[model samples]
Target: MPDDRVEVEEEPVSETRLSLTADCGSCFGLCCVALPFTASADFAINKEAGKPCRNLREDFGCGIHTQLRQKGFNGCTVYDCFGAGQHLSQGTFGGTDWRREPKSAQQMFEVFPVMRQLHELLWYLNEALTLAPAKPVHADLRELLARTEALTGGSAEELARLDVPGHRQQVNLLLLRTSELVRAQVPGKKRNRRGADLIGAKLRKAELRGADLRGAYLIAADLTGADLRDADLIGADLRDAQLAGADLTGAFFLTQPQVNAAKGDPSTRLPGRLTRPAHW
Candidate 1:
């Protein structure tokens, strides 16, 4: 899986703040091999899990990386491992490439998804700590972050048996609290659309400020020119959503993958942390 190929400044992440951005260079192309994808608008071919993508180079780089979208690999452009690939390749497996250590191939592949989930949790927790409104739960968030980070360092066998869903539930609580704290700062009535199926819904220029859009299916929704400031957009499905000129400034928990999937432009107001997709 190729990462969101957006050009931006790569900052040095602190020890406490894990790098949420995907670093494919330091990885062994685990996602390209471990994950399965069917032919669709996003992918051009069908590949089984644990099968290395034909486009994967011997050096673990994508053969057509620069032309991924052109070659019908749009899905690859939006997939982000949140730095899990490098961590698993170097940290968990001690820099042992699966191609060399054939015996550990299956374990490494199985552990990839688990580590990705843990890293995603760490990303959310780290962001929660930065919000001034979420200060009340900052300590609790840090504690959970430490615990989650510790889990990421677990051995392959330990990670394989981990209760990822249960762990996600625990992290979601703090993230929910953080969302409430942050959204409360916005004035007036806020919409509660959490987990709502608004696929392809026409929401052009809608007043969605401080809306609770967590886990909402907004796929291909027309959100052009909408006011989304301070919205809680965690886990929102934004694939092919029309976001041209929408205001997402200060939106909390809006990950890069979501932004990359949406159709945005120069006028789209994004939070500082995320970069504009190249194709947009």
Candidate 2:
């Protein structure tokens, strides 16, 4: 049976201020309108892309803000806007509420997602640069960070017209470099099992903490009851990875959406922000 009594801690809003990152509260609820969600694995309802969610209030706040999960909208709880939604909705657009400015609403909505992507990249790029082992790529990191930040600060029109995929490609290059630097410091023969076909591997109760299993094809691996504390699961393809009773506490760089996209049973352990996999 699942321990329903185990309380999940909410992410402290104050953690956003510790870094020079995007501030979601400063902007209006742009993501609610700009991004579309479908009744897929992540969302419980079929929402058209670019349509405002039914829970979004006229003032641009979430109607289900406090009771998101209880209302079957748990996906909203794990999403972090990196402050770009508010920045574009309020700062760059001069506090013009999208509802009141009907003509500009479409443009505002379009630009919101673009800025969100840029800000998300900034978040990951900033995190990559913080690794001590990535010192050799410090100069490149600095340059990329500056460029990404500047792109986020562009006008709504400019942001809407921006080639976000190109920028993402550039950041991916830096991430590749950072990965190499970190893994080179690992004092062991590089695991040939990387990106290996590990579907249905009996890794139950295994201790894989702090392991470099990047980009490993771990589809359908029976990781039940495994200890993955502080694991570097970046780029690990965990589609269908059996996480029943597995402990993923403190797994670094593990995104909520990515975890939500996987399959897990009720006994699965997850980071605080995510609920048990809905498909479990």
TM-score of each: 0.94, 0.72
TM-score of 2: 0.72
lDDT of 1 by residue, 72-188 (tens): 999999999999999999889999899999999999999999999999888888777777778789899989999999898799999999999999999998999998888887788
How does model 1 fare in lDDT? 0.89
Q: Which ten residues in a row have the lowest lDDT in candidate 1?
A: 1-10
Off by over 4 Å in 2: 1-24, 189-202, 207-232, 235-252, 256-280
Q: Which 10 successive residues of model 2 have the least lDDT summed? A: 1-10
What is the Cα-based lDDT of residue 181 in candidate 1?
Answer: 83
Whole-model Cα lDDT of every candidate shown, in order = 0.89, 0.67
